[model samples]
Target: MNNTALLKPETARDEVYAAPLKDLNPAQPALFQANTMFSIFERLRAEDPVHYTPESDFGAFWSVTKYKDIMAVDTNHEVFSSEGGITIGDQPMEEGPLPMFIAMDPPKHDIQRKTVTPAVSPMNLARLEPLIRERAGKILDGLPIGEEFDWVDKVSMELTAMTLATLFGIPQEDRRKLTYWSDVVTAAPGQGLIDTLDQKFEIFVEYHAYFTELWNQRVNADPQPDLISMLAHGEATRNMEPREYFGNVVLLTVGGNDTTRNTISGSVLALNQNPDQYKKLRENPDLIPSMVSETIRWQTPLAHMRRRALQDIELGGKQIKKGDKVVMWYVSGNRDDEVIENPNDYIIDRPRVRNHLSFGFGIHRCVGNRLAELQLKVIWEEILKRFPTVEVAGEPKRSYSTFVRGYERLPVIIPSRL
Candidate 1:
């Protein structure tokens, strides 16, 4: 079999999509940094949905690339545990693991997650809707017409950061710090965010100190609806270890901030790139909900979640041994052609729009998903009401980590209203 000849043309045509299995290592952060991950994911889904990489920077691991296989691993928490950590790289052993509920299994995960669930519940969303709309209106109306700006900074970050502050009942002035900490938590060295472990630790130390002050303030006061108060007063979470407290804070902050902000940025990029679909959206603003769902599917904000195998399991004809690290590549699964028709196209009005892997399928699914959707829907609705179009000024600057499929800057200019 002349593997090179067959693979070479496809590799040249779509460089990321046709690499030979021997040369394929999906865990390499460089693939993500280069934004060529779809090619690797496409090749894997077609050839080997459950493939093993013998060696890589993050050590040996299995990559689960198809839609159903990812769902199986994600839902069967009993077989594939999250206790090892959620990202491909294990948490720094020298410092020890941070005890966030997202990385815990069974009873502990259930109880702790329940504490913060109310903050994003249907009733709470109703409380936050008017506030979100007001903020979205202000942010969009404030953008300089016909002048270019980083949409990520002016709109995406500001909105999500403000909402995060509201959820925590923190001062509006300090909201940007939550965005900073979330970026630092996912960033690796040379990603141009944090350059060294010492630097990372310093930022986290400050984060711990700041949030500890808030926790202290909340614990002594009468109960409130904010997340800090929920944790301070909840039966499962009160009296938490300092690291555990820090871990949960990171979880909520990153979960709330990154997913929404990135999607907001990504939706603009997706819509602009697909002008026909953008035209559809403009012609019918009622497609906002479907567009919101499609943007999440297309962006897949958090690329993959790592789970450690609790017992040997057979999946997609591959044997995964106990303790082996298995990554459910949601970004890949969301693009699987077997499940999603026209998987690569950013069609806003796709039928069964919600049937995608942006949010995991089981108990560990993103709890704040509805809130993220609400923020996006409100912002887009506001944008359409004002500007005829939001033009992309130039190429987007994407985030550097494999785990966070997001943009760092999206330059755009909104022409004066018609």
Candidate 2:
């Protein structure tokens, strides 16, 4: 529990079992920041699949860690509503609750989601693929080979920021602003991005102003292929309230941002940790698609999705009351042994690699799920063509949040590019 001496996975394994299941608080951002929460999740999955804590940093919430149980809660949108919010600790916006589709229920969720769906549609992503590959190649090629560099910042953040900007039809030059705003939205106090809630709200004010200007510009011009134009002209979303529009834009921005960025970082670390998988991938570059899916499952980038129970329901022999916070730990569920064979092992050729819960299930499943995979696929393909291996030069600094399970900095070296 000492912050001075960070918890190693081995130590975390023993530490988690030492505490009583009821006393364990799975929502601690420190546990995630240290990357030692998996042992805690493993213990919970075996002992208490539907575990609850009376009090914690994010207030009392339920942890649904099993694959089947998570699927139940995720799929039954009617029973477990996202209306409360997606993250366990839902921070209220200064402007009040942003009415985004990912957090809305029923007919309303469908309407708002439909409006922006085209921005990331298959047709749209197909058009974007060449650009993603070009950007990925450029990003990778620009890396200082044989020298240690932060992959999360250099490759992950930069590439995702560009893609996010392209998706929104914003200037690629201003992409880092998108990256900064996305990080601020999810960062908590002392996380290194921003310190206080007030700072976060202030950043959003600027973010809202910029996006609102884009909306105004697009609303007047003929409809364009960009997301802002889509929202500016969509039948249901055109007359949206300011907060409502901001909510949807944030949803798309962060949704497009986090999942791909983190997973890209994770894939490198995973391949290094599992050298056999790396060998397999190197020998058969055709496995890049499978590797991407496996990495998504292995990383489970967005750790958990939270929902407020709409009605009382029995799950895993425990009663979940209406209004209770229910969290589907996708990170844990992906490692559940019941559904996945050798769940903890990172196998690039694992069968049904896409069967994992990283991208929630049912109505609220990640809208940009395919786009995320496509980005990873293209990036990895470019990586394979260039580097023999991206060696992890040092330990990674994991993201400091329970919600955004990703790396902040990953020191890696591309010894020599081919």
Highest lDDT: give the candidate number.
Answer: 1
Which stretches of model 1 miss by more than 4 angstroms?
1-19
Off by over 4 Å in 2: 1-8
Q: Candidate 2 at residue 138, lDDT?
A: 90
Candidate 1 lowest-lDDT run of ten: 1-10
For every candidate, C-alpha RMSD to the true structure in Å: 2.8, 1.7
Clashing residue pairs found in predicted model 2: none
What would the per-residue lDDT of candidate 2 be over residues 274-336, giving only the tens digit for each residue? 999899999999999999999999998899999998888999999999899999999999998
* Consecutive 10-residue window with the lowest summed lDDT within model 2: 1-10
Cα lDDT of candidate 2 equals 0.88
Give the alpha carbon lDDT tens digit for every residue of 1-418 in model 1.
1122233333433754444675677776655655766767777888888988878778888999999999999999899998948999976635687889999998899999999999999999999999999999999888999889999999999999999999999999999999999999988877798889889988888999999999999999999999999999999899888789889998999999999999999999999999999999999999999999999999999999999998989999988998899999999999998899999999999999999999897889999999999999999999999989999999998887779988989999998885
